[model samples]
Target chain A: MVPLSWYLVVAFMLVGLGAYGMIVKKNLIRILIGAEIMGNGVNLALVAFAVYGGAFSFTAQGLIILVISVAAAHTALALVLMLMYNRRYGTVDLSIVQKEEVA
Target chain B: MNWKVKMMQDLQPVLDLFEQFEFFLIAALVLALAYLALEHKDIVYAVFFFGFMASAVAGFFLLLDAPYIAGMQIAVYTGGISALIIFGVLLLPRAQDSSLETFATGRVRTMGLILSGVIMAISGGLALIFPWPETIPEGVPEQSQSLQGLAEWLWQDHGVYIQIIALIILTTLVGAVALLKMEKAEAMSSITGEFGVEAKPSPEPEAETEVVDTEETSEEAAN
Candidate 1:
């Protein structure tokens, strides 16, 4: 098997990219995309650990499916929220939060 | 397609070179697509690249010998989430996204770069420092491979989690519907020209000017 650490490296790199996107991107949907990327990184790590720990396809189905399901639900809610924000304010630009200085 | 057996052949390095090569290849694809998704100026195209990145992750899952999970990832992420986002975009008024400036200036990007680098360093260090066992522990229950095994494990061992997730999905569905209805109600009120609605409003100076006008007319009558 490939050493677990190498898989970890890839996972963390993806997460880092996601973090960068979330922090620097001005659009709400882009931030949500960043969150999805981060979730993917986490799922990658979970599967890698499961495989390396010899659970192979087993944990992949059980835990990873649960994770994916949750992510799917979350995506649906987030899209709705984005739609609401867009309809209300006429834009999804997150920079308005900074101008408003909302806590 | 089933080159997993080939992964057993060991190389000179501490890692399995052939397996590493395939995993890294998929990983690279995932990363590149993720980057493109984040950097793309158009939100729709960004969602497009995100779907591709998710497929690339499914390939990574396949490399790890989890074809079932890989299939689910493809189904949920590419088919479901991406479609949801695209439909959400389509629901918007025309040219709504035209105002969106996706990327920040260099200073913000640089700050994000530094912070992300720090996150990488810390997580990587933790991964390296932790005492990872060489093999699966005897204490942990054996979860067999394949869908049948997964069904049993999910229903028998972890059924509560499934129910909880189902509840969450149900709640999200209801909440999303409610929010959409609320938006419609607000739109109706705005269209009917309801006063004190948050939709239509001018600057505070307009309100102050009205108060000043009333006070000046009262003073003129007094004079």
Candidate 2:
């Protein structure tokens, strides 16, 4: 039988990687990807517990994770779209924004 | 060895092989995809790689007996988020820019990597050393009909929280529309003012084309 600890270890490693990515990456989209990784790690832990702990059903955990994932997707979509719009205006660099000269 | 002994020995080798192969293979693929997503310079490619990583992790989830979460992982992350990210990448003017110089490095990256390594080491050690409780407590239900149970719980226990979250999402959508629409109006006014002429109400496609043309001209001038 596959032990639950293995899943926990994998989830921990993912979360660590995500934290590193968030800390190191400068790009907004990359940071969002990191955030997604972190979210995945949490989902993994949740499911692992549900499977092994016997306190909760797999379905309940699944539904919660599904809702959270959808919410995350919606938020990331909006943010990434906004970032692209900003990039189109010749500035993705967060430090400087050259205001359009309104004639 | 006797016949039974031989059979047991053969089965042991097969089980060991699968144990070694499946676990490490899935873990390596997930980690590699994650690294690629983090390191890729192109936002579009990064998003695509991230989607792969999510799908791989979802596979792992399924293997761990959480099939529902696995399905949602693919549906929400791969289907919805990845598509949105690609759309965002398409909207950017310099979508093809592959400059590694845009990435940050130096002390921060080094520290981040070191910290992550330490965390991983500690967590892995703990996972390996600690003994998990194997036996379930008496009276706890082992199997459940999930969907019906979840529906009952959602309505009875968490209905109000769900309603609040839904309301918040609705407000956010409204706010996003209002903000984007305002920006569009401002940009239109500015473009008209810059041309110093009564701007014809250009069709949406023509307006988009004009914006792209302006971006190309700007890029050319910069070069």
Candidate 3:
């Protein structure tokens, strides 16, 4: 059996990559992609913990599904926001929008 | 001798191979695809890589024996979310504003690098240092049994949560409509060219010049 720590290690590494992407990527859509990466890492870690810790309650599984549903909703809303911003400002570059607002 | 049996025999080795190295295989795929998704210059490629990453994550969930969650991951993240993101990418006027002069340069790039590194270091250290439990607890529930129990729990034990989640989803739908909807007047003007300020006349007369011309024409006509 694979050790639980192996899963944890992967989760952490994926999360780190997500954070890196979130910070370094300037495009709003890319930033959202980074967030989705982080969400996947979190889901993996949660399932791993539930399996290994003997806390394999039904609630854990249900909660995981709930999280997935919420993530979908979040992605929808975020996409809408991005579209609105793009329509209004004509740019998705965060810095450019900030500059426009300041001027 | 049957083809199905022969196919199963052929797949058995592949399954065994994956069972042995599933952890490493899925982890590497997830990380590599995630990096490609984030770092790719073309937004379209990044979106495709992200879909691949989501599928890889779903595979990882299947390896963890959470088939239900795995399916959800595939449906929601890999299919729905990826499609939505691609649509958003298409809607944008330009892919990315990565011009030579203004593309993440100087202090911004340095700061991003530094912050991401610091975050990774902190999280990596914590992951290494945490004293994780060594033993997998006995009596872990089987897959089908767990799925049944989860349904029971959702409908009986934690029923309210299901309702709450549904309400939240409904709220998201309504809120999205509200946000995306233009005012009636604005929409009407946009549809019809009557109030279109964006489409100004090519040779618009100056207000002062128009007034002076009308006065001169009146005087000439009166004389």
Q: Could you list the iRMS of every candidate?
A: 3.1, 3.6, 2.6
lDDT of 2 by residue, A3-39 (tens): 7788889888888888888888766667777888877
CA lDDT, every model vs. true structure: 0.80, 0.70, 0.80
lDDT of 1 by residue, A14-82 (tens): 899999989998888789889999999999999888877744645456777888998999899898888
Clashing pairs in 2: none
Clashing pairs in 1: none
Strongest candidate by DockQ: 3
Output the lDDT of residue A84, model 3: 75
DockQ of each: 0.47, 0.37, 0.48
lDDT (C-alpha) at residue B207 in model 2: 78
lDDT of 3 by residue, B47-128 (tens): 9999999999988888878888888899999899999999987766354434511356667768877877777677667666
lDDT of 2 at B81: 76
What lDDT tens digits, residue by residue, belong to model 3 across residues A8-92? 8788778878887787767888899999999999999998888777666677788888999999999999999997776565567
